[model samples]
Each structure stands twice: as structure tokens, then as C-alpha cells.
Target chain A: MSEDKREMFDEQDDGKVKESRRDFLKKIGVAAAATAAVPAATAKAVSIAETLQSHFELMSDEQKQKAIARLEKRYSEQFGKQTTVANTPAPDGVLFGYALNISKCIGCRRCVEACVRENNQSRDPKIQWIRVLRMNRGNLTFDPKHLNEGKPSSDPLGNYGIQSGGHADKAVGISGEAEHYYNPEQVPEENAFYFPVQCQQCEDPACTRACPVRATYRDPNGIVVIDYNWCIGCRMCQLACPYWARRFNWSEPVLPNEDMNPKTHYLGNRPRMVGVMEKCTFCLQRVRDGRYPACVEACPVGARKFGNLLDPESEVRKVLATKQVFRFKEDFNTEPKFFYYMD
Target chain B: MAEEQMVSVGRRKGQDEVIADKRVFLKRAAAALGVVAAAGLTGTAVIQSARKVGGTNARARCAEEDVRQQQIMVGKQLLLMTEGEKQQMLDRILSSHSRKVS
Candidate 1:
């Protein structure tokens, strides 16, 4: 062996020395422990820092920047996909609003499936943010007779009727007056009209008021958001929302690598752990980047409209003016930003 | 008076020049570190983050797919929606919100 290579034991390199099996074993044990200790220590430190992080509102500009970088790195490793958790503040002079042309909804449920993929909502038990209620014309209640007796509401829809629509009312506490929700093979049921309901992102959010920890609150841009870490998952906000907008994460979010939307925002679709409340941020992840919400883009009929409520020329604002806009449960006086319109 | 005060114009030491002076070296190091930290916080780039996107993951490789393959997009001309769904949309337009049982 060469002079340097011969120092495998290195006993003679430092002067007269010899190797002992005990010493060698002891050294190896320490090396092994150190190797394990590094990652363990790093992980513990990260969790400690996460616990110390201030709320988005409370963070200073410098602190918020650091927080965004930290969250982006953390999510990148966890999902094995590149993620950018931007802390893009709600744009000034912009309050996002949504208006869905109910006359155009076909009850295709494309929006529901799109949301499942876009928002990282659980697939197994199925948490749907947008609930499309297939109601009989002139009635807000679900009636199964549209499909139960194998009779359609009218015309070609009745002729082609299959089965669906029993999921929305009960979840939102509309079941008392509405009994039957049938999913039917085809929709619009001739006599039926569909309107999707999600987080109204109320101008006066009852969910925000109901939050015991004040984890859920409306940001300056008029988007109601949840601070995942601060949320105790007491579910006070869930019960408080007349729209049933908030959802509890009963378990750690299981996101498939290929299905994960790499583009994420800190206040938006970045995945959550087992026991936090999540709700629609109107696709803050995408919208802040000047892109449309997943459901808005996915609608084939071009029914779902979204834009800056502050911009007079925005599509949503135009729809609000030109169409007959209606708010669900407006009697509750929550002042929901979400509007349903028929043109 | 503050604006009128004379400011000294001095030659900036090169990266190599300040090596012998501990305080100057330390101050220079701190300034450089601050710039690096700023770049990192911006997530613009500071020697390319270890957890950057387009790392060796298969999900990173999936970006090679065409834009149409993306799940979320606007005004998609080719409908992934079914024929029946499209027909219903057309029916709504033809009927003009008054699809009468009559």
C-alpha cells in the first residue's frame, strides 16, 4: 500500500499505535450515532421553529419573507414536488368575488372533481368544497322523484335521467326542508337548476367570528383564510359557517406525487396535517398569480365567473350588474361574496 | 444641515484586500451574508436551493407534458366533458333560460 493508503488503521501515523477491535467498534458506534443524530436534531429544530412562527398577520415583512421560504422548502421535500408557497398579499384595490351563472350549470360535477385534484382535498372519504345542488325548478329542496319513480322532470333530461344529487343540503343544514337529492345520469332534469355552494368567504364571515383561536380570518383582499398551525381543529368555525364552508382534516393529507399541484400558496393549497381546518381561498394559489380558479377554468359551459370585485370592468362585476344576482341564505345576513346569477 | 455635511469618498477594498484586518473582513462578510439572505428570502436564487423544483423526482419530469395535459386551465376548446354534458349546454343556449315543458 502507498504511504497514505497504508493508514487504514492509522495507528502508526500518529506515532506508535495499534488497533483494537473494541476501540474500532466503539468508534463505529459513535459514527453511526452521529449519522442518525444529525437528521433527528435537524427535524426537531425545524418543528420547534415551526411552532414559533407568528401568524401571517402578525409577521413583519422580513419575518414573512423568511416564513415563505421555509414553508416552500418544507413542502418541496414532503410532497417530493417543487412547490412555491408565495405570501403574495391580497392585491391592493382588489377584492376577489365569484359569480356562477346558474342558468349555465349542467350538473356535470366536473367542478367537484377538479376541486378534489386542485385543492389537495382527501379522495378516500371525499371532501368536496363546491357542492352543486340539483334542485327541482322553483324549489330549493332535493326531490328524489326526479329519478326515484324512474320519471324525469321533463323533456330530454327526463328521457335520459340516471341518478345523483343527495349530498349538498344535509351538509349545509338544508335537509329539513329538502329531502331528496338524486345524482341522475344526466342533469338540468328539464325542471331542475343547479347552483354550487362553497365558502361564501363572507364579507362578515361567521366562521371567522366563531373561531375560538382566531385562526380563521379575512385578509385585506377579502379572502377568508385559515392559519393551519394555529388552528386547534376544535371545529367551531365549521359549525359556525352557515354555508358549511370549513372542513376538518381528520387525518394527514394523502397527496399522490403526480396529482399534487406544485404551484401552491402559503395561505392556499399547501397540504395540511391531520387536524386542521381548511376551506376555499378562492384558489389563492392560482388567482394571486393571475390565473383563474380550478373550478372556473374547468366549467365547460363557462358558467363560473371570477374577477377582482374592485375592478369595475371585471367579468364577475359585469355579471353581477347584468344578471339577476342572488345570495343563498341571505336572510342569515352573512354578506357572502359568492353570488349566484341567472342571465 | 445633514444633507450639507461633507461625505468621505474612499476606495472600496477589493475582496482580497481586507483579509488582514479582522474588523473590516468581518464587516464585509456580514454585508455579503445579508445580500445572500435577502436573495434566499426572495426565493429568487442563492446558489440554487437544495429542495428546488426540477430535482430528480419523476413529478419534476412530468412538466415535459403539453399544456393541454394540465388538469386546470381556461377556455379549453376541446371538451374533456362528456357529449351529454355538451348537449345540455347547447340546449340551455337554444332554450334561452325558458326550456318549457310546453
Candidate 2:
């Protein structure tokens, strides 16, 4: 019996040892499998992470969601506020008109500088919005003094009788045999006038009509405007303009880091993107808000007159009706809003 | 002879119970180790991914801010006063006082 008992205990112990060994092997097997799976899972997670960090333009839809979520959380934390930015359409019903006083205008180029800053024009050294065309009144032969009455005349063209067609209605001179001494000191004389030229803002603007894609059009206020986003840089409008007012952004406008205008209107003088056509919007932003155009407001000489042409009480209308206004290239019938007048 | 009989009976009955207990203990240890390892690995992956996403988002926000800054500068610089901007630079000079036209 004793021998049998000892044998039974030995048998039980051997069985237990066998089962424990099997359990140990199984546990090790499970651990090894888990270790193998970890690396693959880690690699997958890393690749997904890399995709989320890619640029917004390159992100796929799934990645984009991840990216946007991250951005939203970050922005909220950084700004401590929530804000969404969107593009809004420009306001309507703004008309612009400008008149230059040839009689009072001196040949100073101050209007040029003021216009540059006001319009946020390209800083191209050659880009000037206002061009001072100096010519002699009597001498149509492009005499600088006859046109530039602002300065003392070395060779005043007034002596030549070039502007004097001798017609009594349009004529201003001592028409007899007496020598009319052309005085350089005296201004507002029939002998001298200076004209500054810019976009005509014509009623029948040829530029708008010539655009193939309708990228350019006359706004409700009669101001000609160009949509840069729609423009294909065909340069057709530039050729159609009689005044040579439109300019193409040959390259992206090279603006200084500090010189970009953010409050941009599509039609107004915004910092246009590359390969687009741009022209004066007649300071539409200001005009729509019941303010004078930028160029008009900058002229210290008060030479520029601006107001609604339709409003009888407006200064522009009054000046057009009473003053002896003459439109440039009237024969073409552009009916330009801009005009020149003597003091 | 009697002793041998008792030993065989005892071994037969206890063998199955001891084997079962030993197997259960070993299995429980292995399962606990696996659960802990998986949890650690997954948690680490999640943290790494979140960090990468956050960094990219910060860079994009910086670029947008740069654009806004540029626009503000241009607008302020180009703001010409209405009265001064008019084509009256010369007009003001000539009209400073009434001039006698010859």
C-alpha cells in the first residue's frame, strides 16, 4: 500500500509538471505574436501621422479632415476666440467723376504721388497714375511753356498763335497788328493750359465691350471695373482703351512685405494677382461710402472736382453745366466723365 | 501490496485537479502581460500622431497671419487724404489768391 501511495503522488506531480510546461509555452507564444504585431501597428500609425502633416493643398480628404481638426483646435487655443473669414461682394451704386482745373493747375506732379499712395498702385518705378501733359495753348506743336503755364516761360508758345484759330468765339488774344506780349507770370490766360490724363470712365467704354470673357464691365455707378479672378490676361482691354489707362500686371506685383493692401475689393485698386489686368476703379470703395476719390482728395490745389453727374446739386454736375468744359476725343463719342476747365 | 493499491488510487484522483490548477495560473499571467503590452504600444502611437498633427497646424496659421499683415500695411500706406488727393495740387497754388489775368 505504501509503495502504491508513493507511486500515485509521483504520477500526480509529473502530470502537473507537464500541464504547467504546456501553459508556459502557450503564454510565450502569445507574447511573441503581440510583439510582432506592435511594429506593424506602430508603422501604420507613423505613416498616418506623416499624412496629416502634409500641406493643405496636398492633403487627401481623410487627411484633410485630420488636418482641419488640428488647425481648428490650435487656432482656438492661440487666438482664444473663434473667427471665420470669407470673401464678400463689393457694394454697388457708386458713381465717380473727376474734373481738372487747367487754369488753376500748376505743372507740379504732386497729384502723381498722392495717387500712387492712395490707389495702392504697383511700385514699378515707371508706374504713374496721373500723367502731366504740358503743351502750349497757341502752339499745338507741343511747346512745354504754352501748356505749362505754372512756370516762367523761357520760350512761351503763346507768341506763336498756334492755339488761336482766330475764331472769335474760341479765340483769346489781341488780334490786331499790335504785338501781344505773352506774359509767363500771368496764368489762366488763353495762352496756357495743363491737362492731366487718366482713365476716362466713358459712358460707352470701349475696353469693357472688347473683353471676350466679360471679365471687365461697367459697374452700376458707371465706373469701369475688372474682375481679376476671371481675367485671362489677354490684353484686349488695354488695346481698346483710347486713353491708354489700363495696365497689365506683367508679373506678380512686387509689393514690399509691408505694402500689401488687405481691404481689397475685386474691382477696386487691390493688389492684383499675377497675370491679370488692372485699372482704376475711381476709388469705388470711397465713392460708395460718400467720400471723394483718392486721387481727387490728394490734390492740394483743389483742381480735381468730384460728385455725381446725375445730381444737379453735385459740384461735378454744376461744373459740367456752367463751366466751358471740353471732353478729350469727343469726336469718338466716349462721353468721358473727366473734363478740363479754366479757372 | 495494500500500500501500492492506495498510492495508485490517490494519484489517479489528484492528477487531473493539479494539472488544471497549474494550467489556469500560467494562462492568467500570460494574458495579463499581453494586455499591458498592447495598451502601452497603442497609447504611444496615439500620442505621436497627435503631436505631428498639432505642429503642422501651427505652421499654416503662421502663413495666414503673414498675409494679413502685408495687406494691412499696404492699405495704411496708400490711404491718401481725400482733400489732398484731388487733382487740386496746382489748383490750390493758383487759387491761393486771386491772380490778375493779362
Candidate 3:
């Protein structure tokens, strides 16, 4: 070959060699970076597994056991105690129901305190599942004549036509305006009656129906429950609930290790994370073990009663048979298992 | 003049060959990257499905009879008494209390 041609071929070969070296260096750089990230990726594997885990109801027996074990370990380490998360299914031939005698309640809020202690509710944000509302004794009335008495008078001379100083009529039964934070030195105030509200455990729950993800559902024992992990934090169930029973965790739940109840149920009063909806499970953790709910046991007056509605001899059945009972918002036809009675 | 023209043509041909080689390299690199990404995603999806437990229908099991009875009780309002009956019962209790006080 001519000398110039040989020089041209050598220059092209040099360029090719330089380009191959640059490509090799780029590959080495990527491999080193990936190697450096291995430890962090490994550390996050457990959390990743948890996030990808299936819904609790969809798990088989073995998967459920594995999931429960994982939760127990995590909770035990978190709370500094031996936490046991029970997955007790609904017992056969039993339908749970609740009854409360409005006359017997004193508006003391003992049940509210007891529920917080038992449920491991967030303390810093102060979430309570039970809300006790104070209402006047004759607040509920069917008479239509008294309705117009509360309206403002159109007359210029107020006293001669209608009273100006008098307040509006108390809402016809339980309503949003009822005093939820009344403190008058002591409870059972004169002419005032207490109405404690919690999850009604409805047979046809609108909350369950509104749940797009099917995370909350009614169990065989007539209790509504939520799968915390499966919940998408859409707040649809909270909006659907008429009783204002559901509580949402806006911030990270602050549960002191000392105050944490080590015993928990998968669907009941387990410690929940931020951005999840929680509500009363009728103390299913205790009830499924054949024990009275913490609220029922804590009440000074025996106003709260819980039992299987199927059994003829149960306390709830007896109350249903004889008492003058009424379900809240009966017009909605949600078929709540909870009944309020007058003695 | 002809030799100068030939030299210029040769340099242009060399530049074209280099550009074509770079294009082929880029195409092969892109295809390799795409294959790797597809494999990673498919593997992740397979692992997730394998880890998940099956049978969503089993969780929906509930006692139908108890639910029926509850519906019946609610429909009949068996636990509730009429306003007149409640008043009468309260009056009877008060009268009994008054008699005992006397």
C-alpha cells in the first residue's frame, strides 16, 4: 500500500480504539455505583415485602400465620413488649349485638377513656372511637307545633310578638349540634341526658358499601371491620358513615410503649399507622375471647349490654324482648345492630 | 487537480463510515437496555404474584341465618314498644312506688 493510505488507515484505527476505551469506562462506572447501593436495597427489602403483601382476607392459613408472625415481631420491637396479634375468626352460630340504656348513662365518659386505653389509640393527636353527646331530656319530640317556636320573630317589637332571647329548639333527637364537649363540674347534669355513640356494626353498612377497595367489611358475627393495610386512605368510608364513628390518623400515631396494649387483634384494636381509618370493632379482641368489652366493664352504671343476638338467654336478647328500644337513624335502613333503650 | 479531488473524496468516505458505525452502536445499545428493563419488570411482577396468597372468595364467608334473624328483628321492631304503652308502663311503676311510700 502507498504510505499516505497506510497513514489514513492507522488514524481511523486509533479513533476506534479510543472510543472502545470510553465505553468500557462507562460500564465500569455503572457497575461500581450499583454495587455501592446493594446494602441499602437489601435493608429496604423487608418494607418492600410488607408493602407488596396481599390483603389479610385474601391470605391462606399459612400466609396468615406468616403475616401475623411478621407483625408480631415488628410490633414487639416497636413497643418494647411481647405483642401478640390474634387472627381469631368469627365463631359459628353467633351474631353480636349491643344495647345501651340511655336513662342509665351519666355522661361521665368512662367508656371513652376505657376504649382509648384498650384500643391503643393515638395519644398526641387524641383520637377516641366513642363520642358521648349530652342532650336535654325532652330534646326528641314528634310534635310539629313546637318547631315554629324556635324561629326568629318578624315583628319589630320582639317581646309583644315572639321572644328574642330564647334559643332555638334542641335538635329532634341525636344531631351534630349536641354537646360533645360539655363539662359542668360533674356528669349526669340536671335535666341533661347522655347519649354515647360508637360504631353501630350495621347489617347493611354504608361504609362497607362505599369502600372502593373492599378493605372494610361485615364479619359473620355482625361486626364491621377494616383491614388497615389494604385501606387506601380515600376517606370514602368515613364520609359514608352516618354515626361519625370512624377516626382517621392524620399524623404518625404516638403510642407510648408503657401505654401500649400488647394484646391485639388483626382486624380490631391493633396499633395503626398514619393515613388509615379506624373505628370501633365492638372490642372484638376481648369479645372473641368470651370477655366483656372494656367499656361495658368500666361503666359505673350497668348501662351497656353486649351478647349474641341469636341466643335467647343473652342479655341483649332479653333487652330486645322487653325494653322500649329504638335504633338510631332507623329511617336510613342501615339495620344497625346497636339499640338504644329506655327503662 | 484530479489527484487532489480523489484525496478529498477518500476523506469524505472515511467520515461517512465512522458515522454509520456510531449509529449501529447506538441502536444495539438501546436494544440491550430495553431488553434488560423488560426482564427486570417481568421478574418483579412474577415474584409479587408468587408471594401473594390466593382465594379472595374465602374471606367473604358469613353466617346467613344470623343475618336473616337480625333483619327480621329490625323489620318487626320487636324490641320497641308504642309511645302509649311506654307511658302506661312508666305510670304503673310510679303508682307502685307511691303506694309503697304511703
Say which candidate scores most in lDDT.
Answer: 3
- Predicted complex 3: DockQ: 0.05
| DockQ for all models | 0.01, 0.02, 0.05
Write one digit per residue (lDDT tens) for candidate 2, span A1-343.
Answer: 6766776777787778778777876777676567646755653232345333643334477765664454334334433444221123334423456677665676565676766665566674234556655444433322322332432234241232333222434333222121112234544445444556678888778898889978888766667877665677898987787666776665334445355443434356555554677767777656766678777777768888987654557788577555645555544556567766544
- Quality of candidate 2 docking, DockQ: 0.02
lDDT of 3 by residue, A200-274 (tens): 988778999999999999877878999998898898998788776787776556789999999999999889986
Q: After superposition, how far is residue A341 of candidate 2 from its true place, in Å?
A: 1.5
Give, for candidate 3 chain A, the lowest lDDT window spanning 10 residues. Answer: A157-166
- Tens digits of per-residue lDDT, candidate 3, B1-102, equal 789768867976896798679668866765665565565556656544533321121111112211221222221111244666544433442233234223
In candidate 3, list every pair of residues with a backbone clash.
none
Supply the global lDDT for candidate 2.
0.55
Error of 2 at A276 (Å): 1.6
RMSD of each: 19.8, 20.2, 13.5
- Give the per-residue lDDT of model 2 (tens digit) for B1-102: 689668766766786677678669767866776776677667667756754663454345333432332222110111111333233422332232223337
Q: Please give the distance, in angstroms, between residue A264's alpha carbon in candidate 3 and its true position after superposition.
A: 0.7
Specify the poorest-scoring 10-residue window by lDDT in model 1 chain A: A171-180
Summarize candidate 1's per-residue lDDT along A111-225 as a digit string, tens digits: 9888888888765334567766555452332223332233223433222222322333322212222112447777667766665768887777789899888889887667899
After superposition, candidate 3 runs with Cα above 4 Å error: A1-46, A142-176, B1-102
Higher-TM-score candidate among 2 and 3?
3
TM-score of each: 0.59, 0.48, 0.66
